[model samples]
Target chain A: MKELEDRIRQDGIVREGNVLKVDSFLNHKCDVALYDQMGAEWARLFEGKKVDKILTIESSGIGIACVAATHFHNAPVVFARKTESKNLDGEQYRTQIKSYTKGRTYEVIVAKRFLERGEHVIILDDFLAMGCALNGLLEICEEAGVVVEGIGIAIEKGFQPGGKSLRERGYQVESLAIVSGMNAETGEIDFA
Target chain B: MKELEDRIRQDGIVREGNVLKVDSFLNHKCDVALYDQMGAEWARLFEGKKVDKILTIESSGIGIACVAATHFHNAPVVFARKTESKNLDGEQYRTQIKSYTKGRTYEVIVAKRFLERGEHVIILDDFLAMGCALNGLLEICEEAGVVVEGIGIAIEKGFQPGGKSLRERGYQVESLAIVSGMNAETGEIDFA
Candidate 1:
């Protein structure tokens, strides 16, 4: 966690409207070593939890979840696709999610066969700000009747309501680095 | 490679319109153990080549490429995003790609800073059929002045012109499993 916070401070760019650009190492250009370490930390945190599967969203979370999965005894990772494709057919659990960055609402779905009833799953994602994406994933998990073991987040905006609301809802959310506040002009970030 | 072919035969679905769906283990619901094996296989195939970075596209390729990066000494993985987002700012290498599955063409972009000039890279993807996606990635690699050491593909439709054309281009392409033919009605697949 300290390593991630340090890396964020060194490379994260704070922009207007609380936008933290970590594309250099977190999302777009990934550091697999750091991702492995994050996975190890999550494994340590959720040691006793039964993680039959790892669920994530497409695009950004796919890399982190897949790499982190190596630390979890290579648990299968099921990423919810944001867009509907010809390849995705058959029964699926679908939900709508609004993207803060992309500024649009899109449907996210997972094959019904992928998430079976009574399966224990841990949801992982890169950023947790408004919690809309997590909520959508939670909806799919709920529909599948799978047990929510825990939530592992790489970075969370602490000043935002997403993390707080989830914690209040009694979900065991473990965010590696929580940005309490950030300054766009000065480029200073405060971690919780 | 034999292991991959065997798994494909067991779990891969032969759908109508020449679609071989390996979503059970490869893309949608990922088998991390199998992914680790793929990474090792690519490492064995592309051995002795300088892999400064691993380049891939978003969604499906991100997971495979990131997991495979571990086999290449934890080489950083850079995934080109398909859509424009607020997080992606500054100069970029952009290309247009037609998706056979999605049935539409979309713009893909990678931040200019990720792919440096003269850096050696290996482009990895989940599937290579018509080679539209790989060609786009290669175009970006050319514009960035990066040396493409090789291309690693999990599965290639040998019946399609993509793999053959790429091989004709004088690039070392290692496909774990090459499917020469498959029957949707009989569910029989032939490997080349």
Candidate 2:
């Protein structure tokens, strides 16, 4: 966690809209070494939990989820699809999520074939902001009758309410780095 | 490669319209152990190449690329963004790729900060079909002045022209499993 925080402070950029851009090593351009360490940390944090599978949103979450899945004994990682594809089966557990980053509402879906009843699902993602995406994934899990094990995130915008809301719901949410605030003009960031 | 081939024969669904869905292990629901074997096989195939980075498209490709990066000495994995996000910087190298699966044209962008000029890059993806995605990625590498050491793919639809085109262009392409044909009715799969 210290290493991730340091990496964020060193490489993260504060953009105009309170966006903490970590494209250098977190999202767009990934550092697998750091991800390995983060996965190990998540393993330690979620140790002894009944985690049968890892669920995450597409694009940014895939890399982190795959890396983290290794630490969870190479558990299968199921990523919700953002776009409709003919390849996907017609019967699916779907939910709509509003993306603050892209400023659009997109449908996230998981094929019913992947998730089943009584499975412990660890919801993972790169960032947790308003909790819309996380909520959508949790909804899919609920519809599939999958038991929510815990939530793992690489970074959390603590200024936002997602993490707090999940905590209120009695979910164990673990974020490696939590950015409480960011200043675009001064390029300063505050962490929780 | 044999392990992957076996997985394909067992779990891969041969759908209508030449679609072979391996979401069970390769893409949507990723098997980290199988991916590790895939990464190792790619490492073995592209041995002796000077690969400084692993470049991949987002969503499905990110998981494989991240896992594959481990076998390449923890090389940084850079996934091209399929959509514009607040986190992406203003400066980037972008390419338009026609998706055969999705039936549309979309832009893939890599931050200019990641792929450096003259750096060796290996592009990894979950599937290789019409070669449009690989061609688009090659264009990004061309624009960034990066040397594409090779391309690594989990499955190559041999019936499609993508793999043949890449090999025709004199680029070394390693596909873990190449499918010669698929019978959707009988669920029979033939691999070359």
Give the poorly placed runs of model 1, Cα more than 4 Å off. Answer: A84-90, B84-90
Taking the tens digit of each residue's C-alpha lDDT, what string does model 2 give over B1-192?
899999999999998999998988988889999999999999999999999999999888999999989999999999988864444456888878998787798888887889899999999999999999899999989989999999999999999999998999999999999999999999999989
DockQ, all models:
0.93, 0.91
**What is the per-residue lDDT of model 1 for residues A1-192, given as tens digits with 9 covering 90 to 100?**
999999999999999999999999999999999999999999999999999999999879999999999998999999999865444456988888998877889898899999999999999999999999999999999999999999999999998899999999999999999999999999999998
- Predicted complex 1: DockQ: 0.93
* Cα lDDT, model 1, residue B78: 96
Best by DockQ: 1
Give me the displacement of residue B93 in model 1, in angstroms.
0.5
User: What would the per-residue lDDT of candidate 2 be over residues A138-174, giving only the tens digit for each residue?
Assistant: 9898889999989999999999999999999999999
